[model samples]
Target: MAKASYLAGVALALAAGSALAADLPSRKAPPPAFVPPPPAFSWTGLYGGVNIGYGFGASSSIRGGELLTQVPGAGPFAGAVDVAAGAWNMPTNLNGVLGGGQIGYNYQFSPWLVVGVEADIQAADLRTSQAAGVSYISPVTGAGVTGYANANQYVDWFGTVRGRLGLTLPSWPNLMIFGTGGFAYGSVESAHRYTRFDGSAPLFATQASATTTSTNTGWTAGGGVEWTPMAFPAWSLKVEYLYTDLGSINQVGTGFYSAGAFGGPATMLVTGNQANFRWHTVRAGVNWHFNPFGSSAPVLAKY
Candidate 1:
């Protein structure tokens, strides 16, 4: 009877353990929680901004020439040409500050690449002037005569339409380095003047001035760095350098040497200069983006 009770007790104990085991939770691994991927660094947006900068002119040399156009007697001198000043090539420089606004659009194809187009207009104050004078004894009347020639180039305003290619590093998604080039256009003006005078008894002077203004077109190329601050995701700042060429200016001026009381009236002269406008500019600017790196962006970045 004692042996029978011990076996029965062991049986009951095993049954209890089995019931407890059935109530316990399963040991299989739980399904992973849904943790979505990080968002992409997108530069896709439309932007507008203002910029200020300084420009250094690379205008090489001014070529000048003069011709004798009119005389008192209407003889061979009516169309006689001298071109004595043709041998002159005067060196000059032009420089100034500029400020303007720009508008552009950017599309991000990948996390590391962006392409865009931009257009800008600027008001500028780039200008320079040069003058030369000479004194000589008149071969005809043995009198002293003074002659002067002055020329200048001024860029009143300018603009550019460009295409840009930009690169972003994976480690620095908010920073981009880019290169740009395109068509450039501007309003340029040139001034040419001439004067002739004598201090003798037939004291007289003749003067003339001419200006040529035109809208010129050329090509421009440059590179720059742009950054978007984490605190100001809707704005970007940039520092850029560009080289621009806006064609050239050619002008013509006229003047006359008068011998009013010297018993003879004298000759007429034409004078002019040709100069080019090219410059390098360094600019800094801030832009306001319409919607960049927003919640609705298409990229679900996996970095």
Candidate 2:
């Protein structure tokens, strides 16, 4: 009976120990929770913006040979005197304020590369004028003579259509540097006038004027840096520089005549005058982007 009780007690103790082990919590940690990856930033979108800036280096010239042709008696003396006498060239260092707006779309080809097309128009106040005089003796009468010329040129407005290539910084994807090139067009006004004097008395005067207000086509190139803030991904700020050339302008002025002491009234015409609109501009602006992906939300990443 004692051996049976001892064996029974040992079996009961073993059963209780087994039950306790079963009730205790697991020691191994639960499998780690599944994590979702974070979304990446993208520059793909349609954008529009406004800009303000300054322009400089608007240089131009007037053909001298053309001016001589406009003179009534210029053909006969063409070989006797310098045909280039009435011709003048001037560099108008035009510097002024400009403001405008732009619209475009961008496609992010890769994490670091982006391409886009943009168009912009601006109103400008760039103008300048100069006057010059020369003295000479008339080949026909051997009389002392003097000539004076005045010129004025201005660019009223300009526009451009361009393609852009950009690269985002490896360290900061929000920052981008870009280059652009394409077609340029603008409106320009030019005026030229010349006056002749014989022995201190007024002889004759001629004037010419032209306008490219319809369409002036040329080429343009530029580069810039842009930044988008983390808090406002849809908004961006940029600083840019551009060089534009609007080809050349040809104009002819009306002729006028006045009588001299020795000869009948001489008629004069001014021709072969050209004005070139080449300028450099620096600007800053803000843009609003219409992103299709979503709000400027930050991307989340999985560890």
Candidate 3:
């Protein structure tokens, strides 16, 4: 009977041990290996964009010209007399709106340094006009002489191919500031008219107009700031300003004159007129970038 009691005690001990083991918390397999996300932004890519902006500070001037007349019996028995000389000083200011598109490629060499090339074309409405007149006594006829002139200048379109250099803040790698310079080309148009009268009677008048569709090549320089957001890694926004000079433009036109003290009528050639073109522009744009190279994943840090 005592042996039986001892075996019962041993059985109870084994049951208690099994229950204790069951009550203890179980071990769980470690969580699946954590994976990091991709980088928030990168400057190395190809981009295309459209821009709209305002243009001001376009300027032009008339260089040189002259007007002369011959009076048959007025100038000590007939000789040509000098009436108008030098240039009609006309300064024009052009201001308007412009819109365009651009394509470019960028390479980020370091955390703060980037280099790139870009090309853009803009259609503009930049036109200006001025009217001026002068009065004097005719040298040969001693008659009252009055002269009036009207001038207009405009630019239809312009383009640029440029190189870019930029720097970024280490604390904010997504924001960049840059300077750009390169080749520029454009089309320009101009027109002018001059009329003269002697003693309330029309003496002579001339009209000259020219359209230069051929590309005028020059230089351009500017600077800008660009920003990219972590939420939209493939896109950026920018604001920029640029100055372009297209050099000088030459224009020629025919002049029709009515004979004064001389005779019936005459046609004269007018030359040696020039207009210089310089423009300034400020623009804002958004760009969409594409990854030509393979993607690189980024690390994650819990806040």
Q: Which candidate number has the best TM-score?
A: 3
Off by over 4 Å in 3: 1-28, 69-83, 138-142, 199-214, 261-271, 292-303
Report the CA-based lDDT of candidate 3 relative to the real structure: 0.74
Per-residue lDDT value at 286 in model 2: 96
Model 1 residue runs over 4 Å out of place are 1-35, 70-82, 135-145, 198-203, 260-267, 294-303
- Encode model 3's per-residue lDDT on 1-303: one tens digit a residue: 999999999999999999999999999999897766555455888999999998776656765354554445543424464445644677777678999999999988777898999999999997777877757775655777666667677778999999999999778988999999999998877676666654534454444444444468899999999998877777889999999888877765556555554343443333555667787899999998887321333545786
Query: Please, what is the whole-model Cα lDDT of each candidate in the order they appear?
Result: 0.79, 0.73, 0.74
lDDT, candidate 2, equals: 0.73
Error of 1 at 117 (Å): 1.2
List the candidates' TM-scores in order: 0.78, 0.78, 0.80
lDDT, residue 150, model 2: 73
**Candidate 1: residue pairs that collide:** none
Evaluate model 1: give its TM-score: 0.78
- List ranges where model 2 is wrong by over 4 Å: 1-38, 63-86, 200-214, 292-303
The residue-level lDDT of candidate 3 at 108 comes to 83
